[model samples]
Target: MTSTLVENHFRIGKLPHIWCPGCGHGIIMRSIAVAIDELGYDKNDVCVVSGIGCSSRAPGYMDFNTLHTLHGRALAYATGVKMANPDLKVIVITGDGDCAAIGGNHLIHASRRNIDITTVVFNNNIYGMTGGQYSPTTPTGEKGTTAPFGNIDRNFDLCNLAKGAGATYVARSTAYHANMVKQQVKAALENKGFSFVEAVSICPTYYGRKNKKGDAVSMMEYLKNSTVNVKAADKLPKEKLEGKFLVGEFYKSEEPEYTEEYKKIIDSFQKER
Candidate 1:
């Protein structure tokens, strides 16, 4: 039987998601749901948006105001939703390819605007839903169907990109660190301006098989061993940190949110009238 949390937050009929066995997207999705539940936000006041990709399917299963929009347009639609109804808590669930490839422009602009929306990127490195193509976040030299000779492009550190683009809150966590993902997501949702959380996930069917990354268990174990918390990383020696990625909050600051600023202009015009 599904837990009460799942029953409450997820569509009961949508149980048994379609993700491949060992895919880490489910864990990331669960983390998002848990974060929302913990925050006690009324489901009707929450809007979940998603673009086309493996991870984009999340909003379909979630029991909330949802928009399964066009590929790479999740953020655009989310921005409109927030502007139209500032009272709604908007959260976007996007995949690496969906957000960082065709949707990259939207991602940067949303961060730049410091809009009041939370974005959770389920980054599985490769384009799992689109035939295992190399994505913007696929590491250099990683194998993908399109890059069987090995991907030569440099990968993006999404957190860095969001921070540079002016996101008020930025953080990263792997699906292996379920609790950390939940914590970061909770913090991101609570922030009043643009927020981003990268949930590094595994694609056992595609990325794993193509890259010879073993099974789901091996990929999960790799995540457990290859990441360090930002706080602990600060205390560890450089040598100890080599080859390990830093997880946890990287940047956060209060900012004038775009919606709020826009409202100020509207109120001024109304007073003038």
Candidate 2:
């Protein structure tokens, strides 16, 4: 199955990715590929966009029409791409820092406009490419190179942020939950309006070592133990839910997609002539 996905979706020459060993970005990237393959999208009809970051490196390895755009500007570029050619399937690959920090304004506005783009966030909780700096999604009290003592700022609940910003679909999964990530990405791709999926990943080299979260296996184990599926979470008592984050689909709704609305205006204007 893995070999089939690689042959169908990945660039063979880019086989060996540069992410540090045990970094979960690879798993998240594979999940995206698997989702695309399962959906059977024509490679040419799919457009993947990314911004500068470790996670952003994924587009170079993917076989789809991809754009490695400027830092925090992937959405802006993707919006133009979708507007110019609404037939394409647009997907954005971004890191926690790239999406929630410098690119945060774009994230919210894209959701506000309900554009037909699927955004998958590879959130390792630190700025892995630039150095082990704390990111917007870095948990409060977690240590990073910049926050050696501990991070004092409150972290953003990205799914909630997207849902509040008007994303038509919102979901969360982890690298440890590879199948779940694939399923969520598939669902996000099918949503017509803006879609957001947060794939919680591990930075074993930096975040793990700095916060003493142990090796890659231990981090994966932590994810397995710490997250509760939203469906089961409702049945569990408050005490059982403490310290456990919720995963699974959080929200979904039907809405007018931004590009389609723009086309409607153009059509109306042409009819008036």
Provide TM-scores for the models.
0.99, 0.98
Best by lDDT: 1
Over 4 Å off, model 2: none
Candidate 2 residue pairs in backbone clash: none
lDDT of each: 0.96, 0.95
Candidate 2 structure quality by residue, lDDT tens digits, 61-93:
999999999998899899999999999999999
lDDT of 1 by residue, 122-161 (tens): 9999999888999999999999999999999999999999
Lowest summed lDDT window (length 10), candidate 2? 1-10
Residue 181 lDDT in candidate 1? 95
TM-score of candidate 2 against the unseen true structure: 0.98
Off by over 4 Å in 1: none
TM-score of 1: 0.99
